[model samples]
Target: MQTAGSIQAQMVGRSGVVATLALCFIIALLEGVDNQSMGVAAPFVARHFGFSPAQMGLAFSIGSLGLLPGAMLGGRLADRLGRKPVLIYSVVVFGIFSIMTAHIWDANSLIFSRFMTGLGLGAAMPNLIALVSEIVPDRLRRTAVSFMYCGIPLGGAIASAIGALSVEGGQWRHVFYVGGFAPLILVPLLIFLLPESRNFLASTVQKEGRIRPAAISTVLFGERRTVLTIALWVTFFFTLSILFFLMNWLPSLLVRQGIKPAQVGVIQVLFNVGGAVGAMGFGWLMDRTRAWMVVLCTYVGIVVALVVLSQSGALGMIYLGAALAGLFLIGAQSILYGLSAVYYPIVMRGTGSGSAVAVGRFGSFFGPFAAGELLAMGFAPPLLIGAAVPLIVIALISTLVVVKRPVVKN
Candidate 1:
């Protein structure tokens, strides 16, 4: 019998695997573009709709609300039905809704369109992570996964570029139109080119009559992994909270910090550029060293970067700080996703990653809203940015706990 591992071995170094990675990267890029589109478009959207900052914050957070359910439901469906179908369906869902966003007439309608778009975006993520994990060789796992995730920051950079263009002459709705229509166009390519996860078919469905309850249960409450799972969730939550806070509010916050309006996009692009570098570097380090150690050190870098950002005195310093922050913060999150890929068994990998992402989405929701509230309360930007320090410390502790736990392979 060809076990999942053996099947993976056969696929190592194949051109098809490279193609798979490329397509997955593009999918992630689209998700990133859509994800950051709102942040880039926020000021414009608010201006058009006469929205308060708080209302804009709500617009930012509400999409994450849809992500929560979409992730949970999508994970379960991917585990049962198959990763390919669920992934394709998610792309279609997000693409169509993103297009619909271009047509919204009011704030409520905008929020509704975004929330629906979130559902598709959320559904696609775990499956992408899980699929890459299943397909790549063990030696290349971290690197491949990290490379795939680089699309996220790259996508964000693309959004910032679009934002810059919008500032020049384009409308914000054009951003939505591009975000929506591109994914719809990609659907056909995905259907024809994307391969189903062989490990999932071989190890999950064929070997077992059906997905066992233990498969799902073991990821959360299994004896060897329970503590690790909890710690992973904590790490994901804090990191994502920080990430979303910056993603949704960084442009506006920089505007408040007296940054030149034109320079805002440059800073955003630099942030994501650093993120891509960090993702690849951390992935290389994790493959070469202890993952937990790499993760711990990365969080430390994040704390230092945040502190620097809070007290930056010059444009150069602020740009450097933003780059460092994106490097470690976003890189650390990518590490968590890679960890989840390696941590769980094939049977429930999608569920495991989805659940973690779902939890992180709550942090995503909280980060922006809390920042808005704090701003409303007249908190300083420095204080607001520095607040993440303690959360990263807590994440560091959780990672320490995870490191001490035994690896459980199902």
Candidate 2:
């Protein structure tokens, strides 16, 4: 690690969480890029291996599969091992596997590498989210989580922009090069600049006794928080199911629609632009009112956007609909994360958020595979309409009914 001032020193007066936010955003951005990066590269890879779109979809799903286990393991690791080591290990392992993905030649090796990358990527977040929530003051937690989630859109847009540019000459490998290299650049910065979360450290101690893993289990899964955590997980899982479907399916689906491959990236940009706007906007909204309320409304908006996008034949209408779909779809998912920060106390924060994210990760894993399966069955673009994404999310949000209780649990 670099010899910069400790996190405690940096967090001295008040500006610490801001710094933590920056780091968390970077981590979240890298995670998002890893998640969607394969989609942008899949077309070229399919052509190279003579694989069908369905096969490619399965491969993309494998990366998400890795995330499922990683999320579970990473969360526990963060609780037991301390957040810094877990984060560092994930970045290094994730980066190494990502680079390996660019080098694999056969389908099996490629799938394996992608899956491993998913594991590293999956492992990183719980620690990061857990760390970030605890590092900030209660008043800032929601906003901080919201801001970090914005990385999803920014990273997706980055992939689109990069893929669009690099794929100009049909050199898809170049896209992987950028994806694999990005984390490397951040690896050193993370080691040098980032500090261990004070809250996570403090969490090691409890009221009745010292911080035991059993205490965390009881506090989170005891009587009250378990159902709430499950609801949060369902909310994210459904949101991701549709979100991943769109991220991976949109480009190929547009291609099948007779839209130019080049223009597909442009379409992705519209969706991501809307996502950034929605996430940022929703984050601000969460601070002012109940997170569940904001998420519920966003889901409704997404349903409307999807319905319009699915049916609208006009390009302008399609753009507007996709953008609006992204706005609701991405923002609603992020709002739950904001809720996680505020809903749990500092001690159980990582375990709380980690459990939700870990469970939600299966959606990330299954989403692309389902899209691929649907497409393989010769599904029509309109049939698999954009509205499907938000529809699933609406069901998930209905499960997360948070009471407007106040404790300031600081």
Candidate 3:
């Protein structure tokens, strides 16, 4: 096994990279469960509190509100305070609030708790990406980063299964109860299991003395790196918009098409399952290529799948189309993350990725809400197809930018 010093000699430090990433992945795994709790628990929580669908939607939107600030702030914190500390603090804080959410008795309390929990939730993601980017060597960075994201869908998958089987098993508060304790269980493991981001350590320290963790920078985004940032964020934006529309809208569409509720649940499971498959496979493929062709194609596939799903008559075909869309649509966007670590240097990695992801979160914020509003308006399939038109345009834009110039700076 290569030591950290050896990694410095080569592009990657092999020894700790595997272990550190595993630790990050595990932490992210539980954190993933935490992330999906709101959506998974929304219906039950709304029933318990007598919340209207609109109110539940607003409750969900509040978290995004926190996420907006958190994304921007987390990027800066990861860059400034160091990835490990920022992640540790954020994870612990989120966990506490998550547990507290289970106890909330009213809409005001729940919304306030969710918003606070989201602060921690929103804050944690950027640093997690930053940490992954910092530890892996330059060549393997993309592959490693992609692997790290597998935690997201894995977490979501676990949530899906729990959500599906336990779909209506208990009070929705139980879901939050589950989310709260999961990360707390990881706190000690993270403290001991996960070390500081290696590059974060390297960039800040020297033979002279100890250095502050946040004061480091990589050469990825020097003064020359300008145009690339814009392109990356553009891809990040539309890709998420595509994925969010499906995750949020597809179920209602299926219900509208006269599918049974149980089958709709099954489709949701497949959607998440396909996402897991895409992310898991993406790592191996990315290890082989630079352009991340899988991601580009997936965007196109998502568009096509959306069109197909819109018109699907057979239940089997509907399921297949949904799975395909999930596979490419959600998975393709995450591939960008994998690509981010590959393209950026360690110093600016967190900022670059977080900024792109932060902007993308805006797409996430509006995409689902807009789709739901449209669905409520009786716009029909054609209008929804029109909504999807932007994705095609975004795909072309991403293709030009990602192929020609992949990396960006904060």
Candidate 4:
């Protein structure tokens, strides 16, 4: 029979894991709010500054450009220093710049502030993924990570609701204000409540000073990891291209399509709401069903949603299409993130996750910029929406290849 002390220890361990997930979820939610802030406020900001389509697109892409370096550096630093301190600093950087976004006097200032904010957000992501991955057992990896990921879309939904409320008032700056302050408020809680990953600590003791350039190359390209890394990069690139494109452009596209701002907010909310549901639902399914099945369902749903969105003119159809798109697009991203966390050993998990995210940041940067350029060149919104289908198909194929390889849990 198990001893009472052993039973007590197990309960404490379970509670600790729950607490960790809860904290990570809150941070992820804040990140999502900030991530979606530009999209929610774009129309109003455009009006405030008289930004052209190309210029607005540039602003969107500039912020994401910060993410590339931030992710690379943040992941590297987390491995060198630790996840908690790095995450704390990242939150502070993003929060301050996010508030600065509310006070920008010109387009130049706005872009700079947003870029700084994205830098902070970028840094936080890999740490969050790494931290959560370490805390959970292999059996619950997808489920745990997916649960944490759900907070992101839920946060986006909250931002969309705020946008809906502020539409008539033109209070666009309030979105940034909320996004800024909430994370700052949560900092104190994180400092006191969050625990550092035991796995990270254990790895540090076992292999001190292994974060060399040579080691990184080996982790990424050595031991037959080359193909896996390439597949991951391709999957992240194409999938995030479509996902970010929709996120940054969808609201503006709806407005241009003659949808009312209020209705557009509703559609945005549905999109994020669908995303939240999909993140959890698909994540759960991944743990139980075949990985290829999830991939097929996710990408196929994306294609169908995009087609429906492109063809739909009525408000109801638009909402349905947007929701479906959100469901699959965000769901697919969560799956990719979970896989990224699982693919590498614990020692290099931060680096692996960070590098993949940085590459995805490139996609995030290009997607909005490309969409903006095309729109400025007089491409129809429907055609642009449909264009994402080809990218999704490519990502689907790459993801299938990735899942076929067996993963060894660290």
Candidate 5:
């Protein structure tokens, strides 16, 4: 028979895992809110700042640009220092900058604030992924990560709700105020309640005993990891490009297509709500089914949704299309994140995941900027959205390669 002490320990461990997952979920939700805040608030921000399409695109892309360096640096620091402290610091950075966003007086100030917010946002994700991955068993990893990530879309739905409420009143700054303050409020709870990754702690002890972790280049590119890295990066880049494009520009496109602001908010809310459901559902499927089947279904869903979004005219149809788009697009993105977590071992997981995310940030940066330029050049909304189909196909191909390869543990 099992000893009572051992069972108690197991129970404590399970509770710890639950707590960590819950905290990570909350943070992910906050990130979703901040990320979508600008998108939902864009119309009002542009009007208040007198920003043209191209300039507004620049604003959207700049925050993503900050994500690049932030991911690289944050991932590196998490490995070197620790996940808990780095994550806390990142939350503080983003929270402060998010608050600053509401107070910006001009374009330069706005850019600066958002870039800093992006830095914090980028930094937090790798740690979140790393921490959750380390805590969960292999069988439960995907579902757990997806469960945490579902917070993002739900949080985004909250932002959309805020936008819907504030849009008529020109209370765009209120969105930022909420995004900025909530994370800060959550900080103390994180400090007291959150635990560092046991895997990271173990690795740190090994490093102290003269068994240093592998060099960064070796961790990412050595031991037959090159192909896997490239495939993962490709998947991240294209997937994120389309996802961010839809996120940042979809509302504006609907408005241009003669949709009312109130209705646009409804579509956005449905989009994120569908995303939250899809993230969890597909993640469950990925855990239970063949990855290729999930990949095929996800990409096909994305294509069909895009087509519907572009071609449909009725509000209900558009709403359905938007929801489907969010369902597959965000679902696929969450799957990629889970894959990255499992692909690398605890020693280099942060850097591996971070690098992939940083590269994806490049695509995220380009998507909105490119779309803005295209729209400025008189591209139709349908044409612009249709263009994402090829990128989705490309992402599907690369993601298949990634899932087929054996995961690297050392």
Candidate 6:
């Protein structure tokens, strides 16, 4: 006779699994659109409001501030409640706030709206990672997670395309409208079609009888998991910082580098395209090799790519460098999500993944802020790109540590 766990796993067959994956992918894609929409519309928004660069940077960072709390609350709630409810509610929250963004009149209002939107984005992510991790076959789990994550860059590319053609022509509010409305449309489908995580129901609730809420500290650092948890946080912090720095500032920076206004969109699209490819390719490699080894190599690739970008004056070299950087930097971050899923058990998976993201979101806030400060100081592109090298090196070393001392599963 099949055990409860085995039966639950089997309940969602191949087609059901595929459907779930598709839903998760769409959720992630919407998240990408919602988050990147701000960056894509930043130049236009700044001009419209007559805001200074510092004010714009603050606007960018403020959204991430909301994500910190959102991730923490959402992840724990998902653990205590069910993943489906939290996931659905998160989408609703962000969608409503995103629509409100279209009506903002000043810096403060924009910040408030984006911050509220961040909460939903933050909450939805951990559950998505945990759900995808639990449902997929063990061997394919990493690849499945990575595949879902590719939606982030794909959405970014889509946002960039829209912004280049439409928003630049003074239709910035349309970006937010699209971001807000599409997710609202998805909510109905999510309500009707999304299934509760079987593993959360079986392994978490059934095993405990009554849910004993695990503290974030106890869940992450308990069972001698401290070193691994810390390393994961460090890795997440640095990688996400770099990723967001580029995501938020790259277009403006490229324009400042004498690149034509029209060409910035193409570079952003190319960057995201490379990111999607790298994420899928590295994910495949992670399943076959030492996962840390794959991550380490990716960070090294990021360093090399940054160096080339720093020195390049030619358009081809600049484009090539951006693509390579995105491939490795964004790709490696996707793999880290998969790694976080693998590190925690079903019971604490939401908390573990969410906490890591919360920490990373803290780091993400600094990326755009620091870039703005540096730009204010008149720092050149080469110096800004060069600064990322040490962070990537730190990430590379952190991966080595994770590999050497694996976290004990709870």
Superposed Cα deviation of residue 395, candidate 6 (Å): 1.2
* TM-score between model 3 and native: 0.85
Hey, what RMSD does candidate 5 come out at? Answer: 3.3
Counting clashing residue pairs in each candidate, in order, gives 0, 2, 5, 0, 0, 0
CA lDDT, candidate 5, residue 148 = 84
Model 2: pairs clashing at backbone N, Cα or C within 3 Å:
2-192, 306-387
TM-score of each predicted structure versus truth: 0.93, 0.90, 0.85, 0.95, 0.95, 0.95
Error of 2 at 387 (Å): 7.1
**Tens digits of per-residue lDDT for model 4, 1-410:** 64432343344366667778999999999888988889999998998889899989988988888888888888878877778889999999999999999999988998899889989999998899888888888888888889999999999998898898985487898889989998999899889877777666655532354433237787688879898899998999888888888999999998888888899899989999999999999988988999999989999999999999999988889989999999999999999888888888877888888998888988999899999999999999999999888888899998998898887585
TM-score for candidate 5:
0.95
Candidate 2 lDDT: 0.73
lDDT of 3: 0.68
RMSD of 6: 2.2
lDDT of 6 at 344: 79
**Which regions of candidate 3 deviate over 4 angstroms?**
1-15, 205-222, 249-261, 290-292, 381-386, 406-410
Q: Candidates 5 and 6: which is better by TM-score?
A: 5
Residues 82-103, candidate 3: write the lDDT tens digits.
Answer: 7878888888878898899888
Candidate 6 lDDT over 1-56, as tens digits, reads: 65564476557667667767999999988888887888888877888989887888
Question: Where in model 2 is the C-alpha error above 4 Å?
Answer: 1-15, 206-211, 215-220, 386-400, 403-408
- Per-residue lDDT of 156 in model 4: 93
Put down candidate 2 lDDT per residue, 1-410, tens digits, no spaces.
Answer: 41222344345344556666787798788776776678777777777778887778888888888888887777776766677788888887777887787787888988899989988988888777766666767776667777888897878888888888887577776656666677778877777777678665544643453345546567467756766666677777777777777787777777767776667787778888789888889888877777557766787787888788788877778788878977988887677667666677655666766777766678876778887888888888787875375457555544446434343364
Better of 3 and 4 by TM-score: 4
Q: Positional deviation of 363 in candidate 3, in angstroms? A: 1.4
